[model samples]
Target: MKKSLICALVIYCFSSVAAYAAENPSVKALLSEMSKASQQLNYQLSYIVINRNTIEPLRYSHAVENNVQLAHLVYLSGPMREIIRRGGEVSYIDSSSEPFTIRANYMVAPTIPLLNSNINELSKYYDFVLLGKAREAGATCQVLRVVSKDGMRYSYVLWVDEKTKLPLRADLVDRDGDILEQFRTISLAVGDGVSKALGELQNVQLPQVLSLPQGNLTHTYWKVSWVPNGFKPEELNRYKLSGTNQMVESQLYSDGLFDFSVYVSDRNDQSLKSQLVRQGRRSLQIYVSGKNEVAVIGDIPPETALRIARSVKFSPVAAKKVADSNAVNNSPETDVAPESSSQ
Candidate 1:
């Protein structure tokens, strides 16, 4: 009996060490390879996005020409929609939104997830665990899970092609382990041929990149007291509702991979009661403060959105100060006239 117990204890220790190694640097290295392969290789991915009862097919082609990244995405079946990326300029052509171009390194459309994500930064707040190999899109792929450290946000299960290091499929999972959406590749092609095919974009005329107005970062009356570990707040934006002309304030927070926005507005008949709603990968939570409504919306768990909404704090004096500052900034001279050195 004593001899058997000693053997079992030794086996457990070795197993624990092996598990640690598999979850740590090894997983991160694989993810790093995936990110590198995505940027360097000229490839095309034909995939489908499944969300609830809807399934949409799309095609994405990416290439690097003259050291500049170029990509194109097209909706395969629906009304004509295409997103083109020529280096830093990304143009969106869709029926719903006006055709426009923006200066951005990555296309914000529904392309492959984590294609350009910063793996080093995400590893700080999430753990990457290897789940061995699986077959996806007619290729042998390595499987992994990106789990949240605090279990307060969603997670992802990814299948990456073993030979090419390209992501083949990714599923967004909520806290309860239910899949909210999935991106699965139906076919893939990689080589210089794909690059030559996309070279025609060099001469394709794209719209001028829009110059977005800078947001005023002045402090506001409302404050979000708490957020997830890696989340960081962005600039505050103040605006008015179109028809009602009611003033509203909003600030966006991001943790590199996921982001959410907090909105504060005076409570009125249109203000929704405290509630939480989650659809696909988006969660929206509204909380009623004294005379204000705090809403948290983004790609987080419902519980997390609720907690963020509840943690908001507001002050009446600060509100007045912000209002006065906005009034001065909106004055006719400042709005309609360019700056002068003498003024």
Candidate 2:
């Protein structure tokens, strides 16, 4: 009797565990489905981007042909700007500049991580939660929230179609839960195969691929004293400023979703003072550290940007100089007694 009771208990426990797992699918599973659907499904999405006071309507379409991926995006109400991604190369066409192409895999659209990034990689920095259900873009959707674990990065709320597993709406929110930017789908169309127009786009003569000057692979001389969890240094390089043509040392950092760049330069432009400036959803923080000027720019809150700028710590050689300058500036001056005696 005792043995039979123990066996029954074990079976019940295993059944309960299996039921729970079935009811609650992992966040990674949901994201993986979204990623696969975005790539494999031939769909056209009409959406609008809302950043602060600016509202821009956009159109995006994706298709696969002969194992090659093709995507196109265009600003519906702008100065005539369009992006076409064919396989590994992306072409940009705009009224302000000549058409150009660059080597890239994914389309540079809003909510990039949701559309292209791997869920396993993004899970390192974010904690995903299933936020239940909603109706968006005339479809029943499952809402999911991706929050930064350390509060150093922005969070996102995504509404994905329940049937298609495609994203219908997304919101970029700050630490305080205020929405900074939003992408809302107006309409979406899924087809059995690639559209004829999109297929023909492959035959169009694309612009010559422009070769970007490579940055120096050497490490930077300075590092940040504090960074949010999962944040990692991406690259360190020196590049010339477009306006003044002045060389500047820059370091890039990312947490798989948001990216910020730190630039150190000798040129001190008073116009770019030690203050936070916000344009749309992006923020820029600029300050002077001893003789070098520092700038941090990204699509983050003002506080985050300011904190990153302040946390920058120079190398030992540079640290000493900065410390000495601070000491001299703060030291009280002594009286000139010898000058009085000579007079």
Candidate 3:
């Protein structure tokens, strides 16, 4: 009997250690390493951006030599719109539109942040529990389920390449069980063979980014009346355009794993609004009526978007009714909402 008891204890000890290791692996460390590697290492990626309205396979070639981060994106089929990003600025020369320039952060750059940076804020809205071992990008990886803490943002499943600590694929879903976005690694490389032209931009000067002076924002400006419990804040900044006088109040909120952006404006006479746009895995919704206009942009199920859109209320109304309630943003004024959306 004593022998049997000893064996049971050994098994239990091993199980406990395994459980701890699964949850305690260096997520932050691995992610930091991945970010550093992408910026300092030389590599190339060939992936497909499968959007709802279109599916165009694309390739990105990047090289980081001598402290420069240079990369470009080229579509395989359709009109080839090329974007070259170097250092802190990005220039896009598209076949459809005139070339333009903009300052961008390494996190939410236009092409795709999934490749350029680490999802550091993911833990705020998700429990990054290990789903055990897996294989991806011709290397070992850990399968992690970025489960959502609330309905405001969607859940994500990710395959983090074990060797490189880079995310191989990510799936975006909604509350009613739908995939709003899927970024998979069809092929990836780690070693040399990076071309200098990948980061090369035509020797053309770009206009200085427009500065409206009121572009700076703080947490005080985003006194949200309501947000899902686990939804993390993804971004909050102003969008200032040249040759325009209207200034916008912008905010971004996410649940660590899932994310969304909200824009508030004093109803411009654009003559169009209260609509949503579905771009492949990405989605954009505009809520406009009377003198108020709000735009919620992200990649989540349409129903979730609708719920989030309706849940938004002005600060004035939030103060009047939700003094005692926990959710001042989701007050009674937004009770009636959409039932479904085709997108």
Candidate 4:
């Protein structure tokens, strides 16, 4: 009789686990629909990006034609700045610089978050939790939370429109549940007319893609000993800060949803022994170690940034390679620091 009871208990436990797993697919399906709708539908969204001290309004329109994606984003308040994406190339137009195009699949500027993110790829590191429903942007929407599995990274609360499945709002929140940055839609229009409006992009003449210089691949003695799982490093870079001209070496890492960069440089007069700063979705942490100053900065929590900065350690490499490169600014062939980019 005890054996039968134990068998029944085991079967019940397995069934409970199976039931819980089955429920997750529905939540993931909602997000999958949101991702598909963002890429497949012709829509227009007028939204405002809100931080602790600033609010910036913008408009974005997207459409897909002949298997080519077309998008345009315009800043409504600032000096006329716009990002235009036609197929795989994205062009930037603004008053400060001449119109230029870059090879990219999505607009890098601040737009609705997670519109083009890979739902399956993110599922590995994040948990999609359904948080019921709410009304947003004049429509009934489904509320969902994309929580980090490890709790070491920031999370997002998303409001997806029920009818259109388009994202209406997203909030980047810390582990303590404080919002760092918000993307809220003020108005949304879903129809083919939006596509018709963006169709003119085919006729607009965009500049050729700029030939971007590659990152400095020089091996360094400094190494980051630890990073959260799912984060992968890119090529190492050595460059001079445009203003201070401080020679620094940096390595950027990303986990598809977030990014952070580790910077190492010799201690100088301007070096700070310890500092931590958090602004919007970005955090910067700097600490002095021995004769070098290390910093970790990106869209992450302040504590994580500081931990990453502290985790950087010295690794002895070939003495000949260190000698050949000598110092950060010693080599004249090193590339200038490029603007920060996300995966």
* Candidate that would win on TM-score: 1
Question: Each candidate's lDDT (Cα)?
Answer: 0.85, 0.77, 0.59, 0.85
Q: Which stretches of candidate 2 lie over 4 Å from their true place?
A: 1-24, 111-113, 242-245, 267-272, 315-343
Residue range 52-128, candidate 1, lDDT tens digits = 98999999999999998989999999789999999889999998778999988988778878898899999999999
True lDDT of residue 20, candidate 1? 78
Give per-residue CA lDDT, model 2, range 282-322, as digits (tens): 88999777766788998767888889888876565543443
List model 3 lDDT by residue over 1-343, tens digit each.
9999999999999999999877558655655566666666666666655445554566676776456677776666777577666667767667787776667644233233345544566555555556677786577877766665554456666677776666666666556556655666678776655654543443446545533333233332223445566555544454434576444556666543346777766576673668878765567878774566767787665666666677665654432232233144433222212211111
Q: Is candidate 1 or candidate 2 better by lDDT?
A: 1
Better of 1 and 3 by TM-score: 1
Per-candidate TM-score against the hidden true structure: 0.88, 0.83, 0.65, 0.86
Q: What is the lDDT of residue 144 in candidate 1?
A: 95
Worst 10 residues of 1 by lDDT: 334-343
Deviating ranges (above 4 Å) for candidate 1? 1-25, 324-343
What ranges in model 4 sit over 4 Å off? 1-25, 216-218, 243-245, 316-324, 327-329, 332-343
Window of ten residues with lowest summed lDDT in model 4: 334-343
Q: Report clash pairs, candidate 3.
A: 51-280, 52-280, 125-255, 225-329, 226-329, 231-254, 231-255, 232-254, 232-255
State, as a TM-score between 0 and 1, how close model 3 is to the true structure.
0.65
